[model samples]
Target chain A: MNWLAVKLPVLVTLGGIFAVLLIASLTVHLLQRRSPGKSYGELRSRVRSWWVMVGVFSLAMVLNRNISLVFFAFMSFLALKEYFSLIPTRRADRRVLFWAYLAIPLQYYWVAQAWYGMFIIFIPVYAFLFLPMRMVTIGETRDFLKAAGTIHWGLMTLVFSLSHLAFLLVLPGAEDKAAGGPGLVLFLVLLTESNDVAQYVWGKSLGRRKIIPKVSPNKTWAGFLGGVATTTALAVGLAPWLTPMDLEHAAMAGLLIGISGFVGDVVVSALKRDLGVKDSGALIPGHGGVLDRIDSLTYTAPLFFHFIRYLYF
Target chain B: MVRLLRFLFFAVLVRLVVLVVLGLNVRRREWLPKAGPALIAANHNSHLDTLVLMSLLPLEMLPRLRPVAAMDYFLGNRLLAWFALHIIGIIPLSRRPQRGSDPLAGCAEALERGDILLLFPEGSRGEPERLARFKTGIAHLTERFPQVPVTPVFLHGLGKALPKGEGLLVPFFCDVFVGEALHWEGDRAGFMAGLERATARLADEGRFPSWD
Candidate 1:
């Protein structure tokens, strides 16, 4: 058995997360009591939901490696499901949606095999080509272009991009400084999620200028910069035990996740606006749906993976 | 023993499918009664409707929950009849009531036992996700017992998933909207209209993946 992967740093990193969640819970509870209204009530539920989300995530990480892969694949499935439910598809593409879903496991299989080449191109190159070809065979010309673009885009955002998280689990380095791939996954997730929270808090407290008023009205320059700085500092602090990156490189990775996380988030916001919905669905209480929670990760995972891959590997 | 089988099959197996494989997005679930002596009127599209509703409540409520289904169809043969009666606990309401016999008798008895009666007012499954004309049975039953709460539920995605003549279960996310519980509005036409209006409101709430 390899003792390197399952060691003390994993526990320490998890403990640190738990401590931060505890403070958040207590703070939110206090805020709710001090100023009980709709917003604070929502904040309370959001914090409560965080506990369950983190609990499930931590359990998956501590389990067998295959379990970890399955967990990520399941998340991909949920995000894809939410995306499909929200969008309107042509009658012809409905059957093609099944093929899109079937690709989830095949995409994850590449991750499990540690075949980076095939994993990178399976959805973008192969799925991109094959989905349209299958639709052509289905004999549907009406709205063919629109159908092809939306289906392939859904697969890329929900399955292909998110699969990078699982692929990080199979990546060959970070075994010594961090608790292998789980640590890197943890680092990316923790920084990204906390960045979201930090931005919300900063915007609510001191936001004066809207970053992208049309796309996401709630986003502010104050929040954006504040979140990036906080995440960068956090990354530098947490990189020693959870990542192989030194302080300088860790800060760079932090900037990458922070900026791309914002872009990913706003893109989902644009999607919801187009669909005329406040939230995607009601799967997660306080957090609209699986898609809502994983939107930022859809970008952060892939960008951070390649960043680490280029620098470390 | 059979009760245990039903409970395990639903609490474990059916719930696994509903929760993971087939996602369920329900609105206003608190409107459902924890105990029975109530009627749950929903639109039926697939056989999965019964299972999806069963999965919503706690498992202990299974014994008292009865779906008022067609007798000849659900209990056509010994094997299916046995499964329906023992495992599903459906009240066998004969679609064609015998002369001078009450079709609603079984349902009334189930309600008298403080059971939750799941009724499909549309009488039978129609096209998936499309509402069909509602039968007057629900109104007649409610008029006979005006006090019982009838929860109007609108189900989507199941019909698309496992509609009639379809064997493969498409894993589409189902939307269940539990409308405000209504009561008998004195007359059959008025009550039927109210039921239609309530279900229509719920149907509009769902963003169904229909090709327009």
Candidate 2:
């Protein structure tokens, strides 16, 4: 009687997702074994946790239309926290950073409420003024320039950059779709994270030439090219389900995220080097920390969000 | 609340600026035995000495290490005074040589409370590259609080970082050398001699320029 409830479409989508994740996990596991110098044994547990995160997010996407925006908003907050912790900011900047933290909820709320015009100005123009004014009021007069610089940089990197994810969710025409934003969240998540995972995998396998010797020693030409290619292929395959695009558009999106993610990783790495810290914190298991995982997303999320908004919205 | 805010504000400012300019070099840091009263007898080098030590130690250990600062100097400016009293939790000592207002009493109280007090035995800023004579106040401190182990500390390059009577901060690498705690028997003369030996040892260690 309820055979329709478990239709081919639902079963097929679920089965396909399970199979993909299973294969990815197994590949990473085997990759770990083959690799001589591994980062940590706890990496296996982290990969398992990633599987759980993907599974839960995928289920949430299918179950509700509104939840996807909330999901990405939470992810943005974690990423931003990781960012601020790793980057060194002065005391005079704390008040401004407190205000910047306020931006997280407001930006996400704009997405949840579907308010477009406000989120746009909230970071660029409004935060720009408010932060500097905060520093000026402190009356230290000495080191005022440094204070201002710290505030502005922290705001731009953590709040303004992360607001893009929310921007993606509220991208018009994404509403009332059967695919529930047409698997846009899933597509973005997969491409960004897969770029990271694939790069690490390939780099470990055959990474002889260092891409940027100073910034990230582990990053290699082999890893970068391999990751971009594999992610592009995945994007092409998932295009029909995720977007109203053919293979070409998906490939372009993957490329955009892949390149931007690489830049993001380098930028955050530079910050870590400046602070003389290895990991932002030891909050995550195999991954260095939340910052290590989301370094790519800090740049990629906003870039991809804007690209989608411009082309499709 | 204003004072607390100011203290936090200045602390963060110094931490941030130092992070950029000097660059922290905390390779291996360890706290002393957590249970007992301890005295960290450091040399008076520069303004950056306290900051260097604070940054080097883990936050868990920071609350216990109270840097002893002069009430007249640190408390002279209202902002610095607030930071010293509230944020840094420095044990304030009067520079005026009055006897009743025993500066070491505060250190004793802190020790009784099971807190670690950082005392600069040189009493005032000296050429950090050279060891200044051990001030009598530490001898007096040990004679009174004989139970607490006097930990000798020497700060290298802090004089270059923020030299004596300097307004501008000099950017340079500084090292905070913490020697093993000095053992004190119940005898006062023995404790004083032990403190001197520990101080000399730390000064010698500071003389060795950091390879880093």
Candidate 3:
């Protein structure tokens, strides 16, 4: 119980975030009410959901040291479900999705168990061998290429890539270390989410040039650069409190998270383009289903986790 | 209600994202103009067809325009079930032969209330963009409500965006050509024959891409 009280710094940090979000929401409401144009009632609703999600994640950081991996694994399951629903698979694809569903809990279990060697290769190696073998036994030929591609891509993006975050949980650190290991997870999440907010704010305000006209027309270079700058500054500022990384390393981490997050967003945009339907499901208000919210994390998790593992683990 | 709207808003956001990514140009064919209590009869080619039709309509017309959808599909979930029935004001019909009910009553009620109704005479999804044989339900509707105008809309390109069994959205611009409203005259067979001819003519124009 004393250890819980000892975590006041982390608690206050999160409280500060809530206070900022509250002020921002009030500002958006006031501006919308006073402005001449119609209020973006939908956009405001989405921002409110973002506030809840950020608060929940921040509170988890204060509640326990080990909840990060569990929290992310749950997110991975939701994201994978959204991905598979949008991308149609054959009846034969059911066998593949079954393997995928099993892989979700197993991969997370590995994280909980802290089996580094097995967790690293569970999908790329073991499940890779196991899933294809299951598919081959089914002996269906129609759209086999598509079936394989869809299942493999689903696993790679949702399970294999996301598991890296869980793998980050067990990385070796000095026994007496205060700001490392679990703290790294907080650092990554903050940078990624902040980048999203910064990009949306800048894009809506000063966006003129489309970043990628074909895939995501609303994305602007102004937004991207603004996001990168803000996230980089945040990472640099928070590194000492959250990780063993120096200023240079923290900047690099932020750079990687921001760039990779943008790339992930573009990739999902292409996927949705391939699937004519928008949003995976309507579970979250203001945000699309679980998939739309975590699309950036699909790419960022693997990259960020590995960077930390290589440098510190 | 706000929560449901929030979910719908995100759904729209996802669609907008896909539309922007794929460059989907949603143009509505206003051949019949904004006539009151009209019936929109279009070929059922793909799932995206309904959304495209709804998107192409004027925003003001959304609350007034009711799309007739299958009961099994639209009524699968509770919230969507409510939205389909009450919010979007969709008219649900049962396709199962075992069940026989006055599906047209809902349509009739809406038309009597002076709201436009969109009905797919095919009653099911098909691969080709061509019109399938018209179900007797449409004929039944016309016979009951002789005053309501039936506008035939030919939409080209949505079949490519979301083909049956394919989940990914392909970017494509489509044109919807609205034909003159056809009224129910004395002869049932002749009225259907005329309806078939109009649809076939639009299909053969070949200016509209076939669902390949």
- Highest DockQ, which number? 1
Runs of candidate 1 with Cα error greater than 4 angstroms are A1-5, A33-39, B76-78, B96-100, B207-209
| Fnat of every candidate, listed in order | 0.57, 0.00, 0.00
* TM-score on alpha carbons, each prediction: 0.93, 0.57, 0.61
The parts of candidate 3 lying over 4 Å away from their true place are A1-6, A65-68, B1-212
Better of 1 and 3 by TM-score: 1
Candidate 1 chain A lowest-lDDT run of ten: A1-10
Better of 2 and 3 by lDDT: 3
Q: Which model is ahead, 1 or 3, in terms of lDDT?
A: 1
Which pairs clash inside model 3? Answer: A273-B169, A274-B168, A274-B169, A275-B167, A275-B168, A275-B169, A276-B168, A276-B169
Score chain A of each prediction against the true chain A by TM-score and list the results: 0.95, 0.84, 0.92
Q: How well docked is model 1, in DockQ terms?
A: 0.56
Instruction: State which candidate has the highest TM-score.
Output: 1
User: Which residue pairs show backbone clashes in model 1?
Assistant: none
Candidate 2: tens digits of C-alpha lDDT, residues A118-237: 777777888778777876776556666765676567566766676666565556777544233535655776688888888888999999999999988899999998988888888787
In angstroms, how far off is A75's CA in candidate 3? Answer: 1.2
Tell me which residue pairs clash in candidate 2.
A91-B12
